[model samples]
Target: MYTSFFLLSSRWSLPMMMSISHRGTGVAMSLGVSLFGLSALVLPGHFADYLDLIRSLSLGPVLIYSAKFALAFPLSFHTWNGIRHLAWDMGKGFKIPQVYQSGVLVLVLTVLSSVGIAAM
Candidate 1:
């Protein structure tokens, strides 16, 4: 059974992959936010102090933008995919084609929004 699972893994559909990604991203964001929040409260310095420290490094704009995009992509993907899930709950987009289209739509929107945000 386990061997079959691995052999068939490559055949997983987009919807299947997206469903797994959605759950994974949810867990990742939850852990990240929790850790970041705890650090903000428990650490000796203010959030702005941390910001100042990062600024002191004087990283180039390309690296800074890349970092911002990396941070933004997960949140963006999760948010858009979440809305897609909500539509599913409402009994819309149940057809196979609709499912794949919605998944692609979510990816496009995630990229565009993440880029727009990181550009700021």
Candidate 2:
């Protein structure tokens, strides 16, 4: 079963993979943001206190930047893919070639925007 699953997944085309990724990232971002907001509401300290706690860890700049990139990537991907989805909803870009082209465009835009946000 596992072998078959892996084989099937490996055979996914770019658009298929991007569609799956869009749903996965949407779920992840929703959960992450919800948990974060809930934590802020229930935590015993101000937001700056948590910020200070993280700062106290003294993690290196590289690690911090990597963390930022990790967080930004899903958000960027979801946002771009969502735009694609909206276009699809409007009866646009339904052709196979157009679908593939839009998928690639979304990926490129996602990467660029994610990196830009992470750099800050």
Best by lDDT: 1
Model 1 worst lDDT window (10 residues): 7-16
TM-score, per-candidate, Cα-based: 0.90, 0.87
Clashing pairs in 2: none
lDDT tens digits, residue span 4-108, model 1? 889878687899889899999999999999999999889997899899999999999999999999999999999999999999999999999999999999999
What's the number of clashes in each of the models? 0, 0
lDDT of 2: 0.94
Off by over 4 Å in 2: 1-10
lDDT of 1 at 80: 99
lDDT of model 2, residue 26? 88
User: Residue pairs in steric clash, candidate 1?
Assistant: none
